[model samples]
Target: MYQVRVLVLCGAHPLYTNWTAPRSTFTSLLPRAKDRHWSLLLHQGLPLNNMAIFAKAPTTCVSFLLPGPVIIQTDEASSEVLYPNYQNCWSLREKTRGRKKAAILQPGISKDLEKVKAGVGINSSDEVDFFVLLDNVAAEQVHSLLSCPALKRFAQMIEQRAVDTALYMLQEEDREGIQMAVGPFLHLLEGNLLKAADPTTPSGKTRKLYLYATHDVTLMPILMALGIFDHKWPPFAADLTMELYQHQESKEWFVQLYYHGEEQVPRGCPDKLCPLDKFLNTMSLYAVSPEKYHMLCSQAQTMELGE
Candidate 1:
């Protein structure tokens, strides 16, 4: 049986890069800011993306993506744990997804099936439905705003601005975040591809698929790290796929990359198809070896100012 490892990553968070709430833009999304009591929500982790600014102090909210690797036996019928659930849909709008998208679903905090996890303010049926619709709105915004140029720049700027660690905790978080996910994925990639190419290896004859089911939070950093992300947001179900092929003529292997169905030329890949040897060599720099991802997590968190 082939043991395949898959990575699942994403988290809900709010990021502020030198914001000034009550700025002119706040009137655009939050018209009632002047009259409504927003500090409560703000304190409760409501993400106000470029939402004009709020406080003089920097904000620290938990919006993260980690590469959680789970090994599944490819030959087994019981390997259904990695799939998505068909039930339990939540449509809340309290939490914002990211810059390009507005607030969306933060479903009932249920850990197991059979019962609904009690939420803070979900008292009535109307509130429950409102939360569901909030999720829908967040999804709609994602569908409409993901590919904008501003998003690409926004993504790029986050990385660029992150260099100055005085503003935010981005430098370590961004790098460590990627090291957690991409690094592992790369490990799986290189190891599996090598196995597939080696005739002496026991599992060399088997074909494998390395799947990653992630939230946009983690995808943004990874895309940026790959140097292919144009700073725009990626929609749901979007995938960054890579395939390996063997050449019968030279007995060599090669790699092809794709992002959201479009062929992508990664930093090392000059063409649509890159020789597997070259691809590995080019990609070797990114895979964080010698250091475990959890090590990064164990360190203390930092807070920096925004540019």
Candidate 2:
């Protein structure tokens, strides 16, 4: 029986850098934030931010990804016990998959900020700073601060504006934005899919599951590239899964996507599980080969140096 192959890609756990609070304030708030929420998610009483927490209980990252309460007993020391449910996983060292394109993408955000300033009721730089502070707080703890209906509405507006600005620069405003942000990931994903479809080829080693640990920067772009981004800030430990299925009789491969847990239909595909060819065609708009990626990065760097 040939079981369906699955690819699970997800962002990392909450990190110090994920917070937008000032450095001085962050020193205090980080601990409080952890004490309030993150403490419950800890594994075996281990401290928050412990890298070994994931190593010991891989499924403790978040609620949706948690298959069950993985109990790792120190007495039963085995690889299977430590890392359950998966056989093979690879970590791409170059975590900044599209760092070169980030510069090209950043300039458009100023335009996004300009577009939203009026809507946000910000007339001055100080007001802009206030708006940002409020937005960050709302994102982290909306219910805690925003108790009044009017205040909650304002907070929602601020949060929406922030989310929209990020999404606009990533996908909504221009096609190139999506292309630049997702090109590297698309290239890797397409190559992997193609290889997994073939069995005879030397490089085509079939693996039942593939997991990619990444950050929101990588997750948002891939989602936007696939035309399924929900336009909200991706939460910590958010996952996007791509499942490849082979028909029992015909043996043709098909692709289906899930974000967090909800099934998603790709941009132009008719249904949830789309034919691999059509899926590749939809992805072709953003895939950047290594050679093209290098050339673009070089050009960008040269232009920046010249300027």
Candidate 3:
């Protein structure tokens, strides 16, 4: 059987990190997987300043490209409307134009989570063929605006966008034989991983499987939601990483988590512009091993924050 090395890239920002450590690491790593097909999976967080670099290399064997960063504004009035019950106000506004929403909604968190559970075909006895990846940011602070009542109305809109993006890629004809990669909120990562990792189902039969959670500091709450950590702990102040690698011959996947150095970018994208090639080359050399990369994603459902 042929092995495909899929690289899922996401983090605080790429351009401003000096482009040497992580970049060089990744470059060296990709070529090492000799005899295997090398596929690059670009998640969210690529900077707007670096858009030119990505656009210039359209045919560079990229298996998937998610919509870039988006900004959400929470004005006082909007916040009041969205989080009326909490004695605090919250608002949700798009930071970037033409960006898409994240996931489909189902009334309440329980209901929405139920829908996600169903998507993984959890109840089915047969193995559903797919892998999962979750890209998110870590929210450093909990704003009263996050609890706004008005924001709830748009919940479904956000959920639909995220789900649609994954489903769309899954439906592509060329993707049939390849292992699946599912990206969801960090809070949802543990559950998704458990579901996808279940050994009883047919979906778990794939020889090689992977589930990636990509994000920056905004991943805190979702991690809390997943019970991975607690709110009292400072939000994931540094870059955190995790990996799940399946041994094709054994069908057993090894999972590990790592903490990379702290990144100081505010919105996730880099403050400066760097050529895409330079960045990719850097990634090739600096990419972390499954056991040592940090994860800094969030569970925000809106496009603005989702990216």
Candidate 4:
């Protein structure tokens, strides 16, 4: 029996930087599981950034790559946990570092903002699926603030103009970077696997596969675009996690996402997002079957977000 192991590292922005470095705790943790053939999945840009950091390391480290095939995918979700009420001077001051210029807005931009506000609404689910929703109070506060006409208008404008521009640039950069780093590894594995299997004779036997993803919060939008996550709602802290197991009794893989840590609302909060670490540890041990694994790979292939 092939014992499949899936490990996920979850946290906010900076933690990703740590994982990509040679001397970081993430590297140290790798050896502990080295005995088993491993695969990696980064939820957002974490894996991409980590790879860049690894390349810069002075000492050559072979441990970063697994003996088997490694697959990397990028997830694009927003990292903004606390949506402040830009309409309120005090709130705006706090969030903008008391800079009047930062808080002030132009008229044309404000008009476009109203259109954006009209386009989106808050999520009203009682039991939220991810960790970021844990802070009910904070979530509510943000909701209330965002509901304001002025702030909503401004947010919409920013989303269309500034936010979209930056996200597009980052997404392209990350996608290209991950492909360059792992492309060769993927080709090698695919070639070897194809040769091992007899093409002339159709065999019913299925192979066990391991997979991983690395990505960033912006991954949420990409996921939604690719039809992986249907809910139009943005991802939250606890929402970021890794899903692992088998598909169709033949294939195995992992899906991951990243969210801001502060977005995790505790259970008592009105929104009720779970804790990050607890959620991940729970899912890591979940069971998997070959049929289910095959199904997962099929869906993943259809998603077409990963190269």
Best by lDDT: 2
Pick the winner on TM-score between candidates 3 and 4: 3
Q: List, residue by residue over 1-307, the lDDT tens digit for candidate 1.
A: 4332332222222223212332223334444544222322232322322121212322333332323433444644221211211111010011111311211122222121002212322234333322232233343343332333332333333333222211122222345444543555565567777787777877646655544444544455456556677645454345566788878898777788877668887777778888877777755655554245334433322111221
Residue pairs with colliding backbones in model 2 are none
lDDT of 4 by residue, 160-278 (tens): 44433323322323432222222223333333344334345355453333223433333443332222333333422223332223244644322233333223332222333333333
What candidate 2 gets wrong by more than 4 Å, as runs, is 1-135, 142-153, 171-173, 202-204, 300-307
Cα-lDDT of candidate 2: 0.51
Instruction: Put down candidate 2 lDDT per residue, 103-152, tens digits, no spaces.
Output: 22456544544445544455534334223534444434412322334334
TM-score of 2: 0.54
Q: Scored by Cα lDDT, where does model 4 land? A: 0.31
TM-score ranking from best candidate downward: 2, 1, 3, 4
Tell me the spans in candidate 1 whose CA falls farther than 4 Å from its real position. Answer: 1-136, 141-177, 203-205, 289-291, 299-307
Per-candidate TM equals 0.44, 0.54, 0.25, 0.23
lDDT of each: 0.42, 0.51, 0.29, 0.31
Candidate 3 lDDT by residue in tens digits, 265-306: 121223223222232232232222222211201112333465
Better of 1 and 3 by TM-score: 1
